[model samples]
Target: MDQYKYIVVEGNIGSGKTSLAKMISQEHDRELILEEFADNTFLPQFYNQPERYAFPLELSFLAARYHQLKKKLTALPLKTFVSDYLFDKSLLFAKVNLKEEEFGLYRTFFELLERDIPKPDLIIYLDKDIAKLQANIEKRGRPFEKDISNTYLENIQIGYEKILSDSGLNVLKINSGELDFVKNESHFKKVINRILTY
Candidate 1:
């Protein structure tokens, strides 16, 4: 864990990536970087009508992620940093949500922005079943997220699998279907130990 200057905790929606990232950052005394998804006004609209708002939603997210990563990575002192998302998450979600032609155009912008961003040294992926993910989503009780169908979650999971398989980054995938690291201290300790031993 100390060898990794930048670590990314990735997972499907409601998989508790943000929570795990926060815990890691605090425990390790690393700087934390979280995705600002709530700031995007197009999110709720995209959920309500995906086809109508998919392109703009993805585009907005891409630009926002690029700017946020660039600013934070550039300004921060050289030290360990834990982020809840990978920079390529924009591409993963775009590929899932956009049409073929729209994706082609989105990829063009994505590739250009990606070249300037820093990559993570290690990626900690929280792997959870769709059932667990849905249950967690419901527990969170966000109105915009209430309508997230199983099919959509499955697609996102598949997208993540495809991207991660070819990413060439050092990745540690954890089976989190039964783990409640937030409330269970043992589970959290296990996660930390896995990172340290990996």
Candidate 2:
């Protein structure tokens, strides 16, 4: 994290990536770019009927993330940046949730818009157990996330791990189950130290 100017915090739902990204931005006093998933009108339906709604939901996210990244790439200098979502990760969800025919159209649009986006300098992939992820998702109480099954979440978790494994990013793997960085200052400090030394 020392020389990195762009940092992307990535994880499955309720893995605390947004909370951690906010903390990093405040700690370093840098710019924070977060995902506005709740703003998507299709997200709730997508969560409830993934097979039917996956394409539109993923496409909406891709469009929004593309626009956000395009603006950031033009305006933000090579200073520190913490983003809750990575642009390419949109495809991860699309491929996982959408049918082959659906993903075909989704990929076409994604590639068209992603041509000019800046890649992250580092990606922090937060890891967590399925049960812990479900518990956290339940506690957060997003209306759309209410019916999220452990099985669906587990599929997403597996997809995330696979993506991170293949990505040549400066990835810092954190076990969210063990580290309650939100409430534990000392633990959070330790994580910061680790990131600083990375």
Candidate 3:
């Protein structure tokens, strides 16, 4: 576990990746790198009108993800680091959100920048049922997320599963649909222990 730096805690929108990453970073004094989704001005519009906004939204996210990872990841020559996402998240969401033509263009751009970004040494996937995911999304009370559909989330989940399985990176998939790592100290400790054993 000590040797595994650059750990990524990844999941769908409401799967609690940020919370878990924060907890892990705080507990272990690792650098926490969270996705700056709020910086994407296209997000709210995309959720409202995906067909009209998908291309730009994905492109914006792709740029942001690449830039952030390049900046923060470059700093970690040693010591533990945890992030709420993987750079491949852009690819996953682009497939779900973009048209075929749009994704083709996006993929070309993605491939260009991907080689320069740092890959995670260990990726911990937190899986939750769609129902629970929706519940958590609602609990977060983000206005734009209120419009997010179950079908869309399901598609994202499916794409995520495929990408993670085929990622060719070190990954541990956890069935965390029932656990609340946020409020429960026991659950959080258990998660930490599992990560340590990795």
Identify the candidate with maximal lDDT.
Answer: 1
Q: Give the Å shift of residue 33 in candidate 1.
A: 0.4
Is 2 or 3 the stronger prediction by TM-score? 3
Error (Å) of candidate 2 at residue 31 is: 0.1
Structural similarity to truth (TM-score) of each candidate: 0.98, 0.95, 0.97
> Against the correct fold, how does model 3 do in TM-score?
0.97
User: Which structure is stronger by TM-score: 1 or 2?
Assistant: 1
The pairs that clash in candidate 2 are: none
Task: Output the lDDT of residue 15, model 3.
Answer: 95
Give the CA lDDT, 0 to 100, for residue 168 in model 2: 78
Off by over 4 Å in 1: none
> Which residue pairs come into collision in candidate 3?
none
> For residues 1-198, what per-residue lDDT tens digits would candidate 3 score against the true structure?
677778999999899999999988898899888999886889999888889999999988888888888888786676678999999989999999989998999999999999999888899999999999999999989999998889999999999999998989999888898788888999988888887776
- Tell me which of candidates 1 and 2 scores higher on lDDT: 1
lDDT score for residue 24 of model 2: 92
Q: Give per-residue CA lDDT, model 2, range 1-198, as digits (tens).
A: 558888899998888999999999998887899998778999888877777788778888898998888888678676678999988888888988889998898889888887788888888888889888888988988888888888888888888888788877678887777888899999789878878887
Clashes of each: 0, 0, 0
Q: Over all chains combined, what TM-score does candidate 2 have?
A: 0.95
